[model samples]
Target: MAARRPARAAAANGEVRTGGSGRSDRRAELLRIAAGLFATRGYKQTTVRDIADEAGILSGSLYHHFSSKEEMLDEILRDFLGRLLERFTAIEEQGRDPKQVLDQLIEHSFATIHETPEAVALYQNESGALSGQPGFAYVDQLGRKIEEIWIRALTAGQKSGVFRDDVDAGMTYRFIRDTVWCAVRWYRPRGRFRHEAVAEQYLRVLYGGLVTE
Candidate 1:
């Protein structure tokens, strides 16, 4: 599934939205350029000048949209994680059986990896160090909330006999979480297997043991 882009042009709290079409498009384009650079180059290594150079704009023009490179990073991560958390929370709230919920969650994750590999990679790369940094504590808090949803589903499945009771829920959750998210390392968006195919095969292996009866 293609990742949805947030509308960065809108204003809340009675703040007026002002920008011509050209400026808005350029702003979005600059963000795209920045995200790509941040994902490919480490965020700290990527300077505002780098972003401006990639966008073919001067640093002054780049600053007109974002106060600093940190602002750009914050906007990218915030939007990426915010959208991800919202989707996962919605899946949890649908009240499906644990197995179904887990299936959807796993599938959605693969799709996310396919659609927003850059964002996924960025989070994986920067989140640990950012945890101790001020103003970025929400990174860890949001991560914990996401972890809880997955663990809850796993526990529910175990209790309902749909999953094994032998494994600890927390450990199992960590294993599954790492396995799914780490695919961003090698997963190519245009690879031979599409995200849906990858998800289906993974689910097959997950639900059925490797040993054939």
Candidate 2:
């Protein structure tokens, strides 16, 4: 399912309503707090009260924005994966060649880890378990869709002689995907190497083999 945007609640005066923006901002903040807790504590271990306490609000007050903890989890995953897929799709569409497409994919992925480490960690740790759960069909669906985009780029590269043809595209894709996404565990936003630098170094090693030619 698509992520639902928070609607502006109408006031009795119908003057676009007071505090609408504040409520939306609060809702986003609550999601961020919940995502961090969920990433570190495990989803099943995190309680609604934990999120509320972190947000400095009463449990009941949290309900004013999100109906339940599950709702918040769903929204977080949906937004994260939805935006990721959208950006990747755009890169593929606009890229001039298969190599260029793959390059941007790797770069954007590192950027995502830098910008939203919690969301990246949460998805990496939880997605496999959530794939078969009810109401999480989109997890698998969108995941496969994202995987296909990468595979397309890799296979196209091989076909066009831009990449080695003997290597299995599926295996190559898995190697690159795991190597890129798993960096979330150790990557730090304030680390000596920024996301762009990390991407550049990775791409250098990836395209230019260590063995002297």
Candidate 3:
């Protein structure tokens, strides 16, 4: 997933809402702050008060926006995964070829990391612990859907000879998935290489052999 872009200005009322109207802008800000905290501090270690303090609001004020820290987590993950799956599905449906689809997928994955590093990191850190937890089933369900899209691209490429046939598509997809998403740990918005440059260089190595021809 990508890092979230910067939050916009909040409403004058100083309240954030998770399920209501008129405060979406402030609500997004609170989610951003909470995602940062959850990514840096373990979810188990983070408190609603911590999120409230970061937002410069009282804990009670935070509750007006979210019923609990868990709700915030759920909302963040659902939004992140939902957007990602929607984009990936569209890429697969509309791409000209398997190679094009795969390239867009890789590029988009990097872009996601750049845009929503906090959410990406939060998912990476907490997904395992969240497995089978009540009210978190969608975490794994959406993950499988996302995985299927990648694997389908890989399979299509191999069948069309755009990718090597000897390699297992499942294994190749796993390698690519891990290599791309794990970049969240070191990728910086102001780093030496921007996400586009990183994706370009990765695609170069991925499609071309490391050895001189």
Model 3 pairs whose backbones collide: 2-112, 2-113, 2-116, 3-115, 3-116, 3-117, 4-115, 4-116
How high is each candidate's TM-score? Answer: 0.89, 0.91, 0.89
Which ten contiguous residues of candidate 3 have the minimum total lDDT? 4-13
Q: Could you say which candidate leads in TM-score?
A: 2
Residues 42-84, candidate 3: write the lDDT tens digits: 8989999899999999999987666678878887897898899
The lowest-lDDT stretch of 10 consecutive residues in candidate 2 is: 6-15
Tens-digit lDDT track for model 2 on 1-213? 233334421121112446667777777788899999999999999999999999998999887777778878887898899899999999999999999999999999999999999999999989999988987788888899999999999999999999999999999999999999999999989999999999999999999969887
Q: Give all candidates' CA lDDT scores.
A: 0.80, 0.88, 0.87
> Which one wins by lDDT: 1 or 3?
3
The prediction achieving the highest lDDT against the true structure is 2
Question: How many times do residue backbones clash in model 2?
Answer: 0
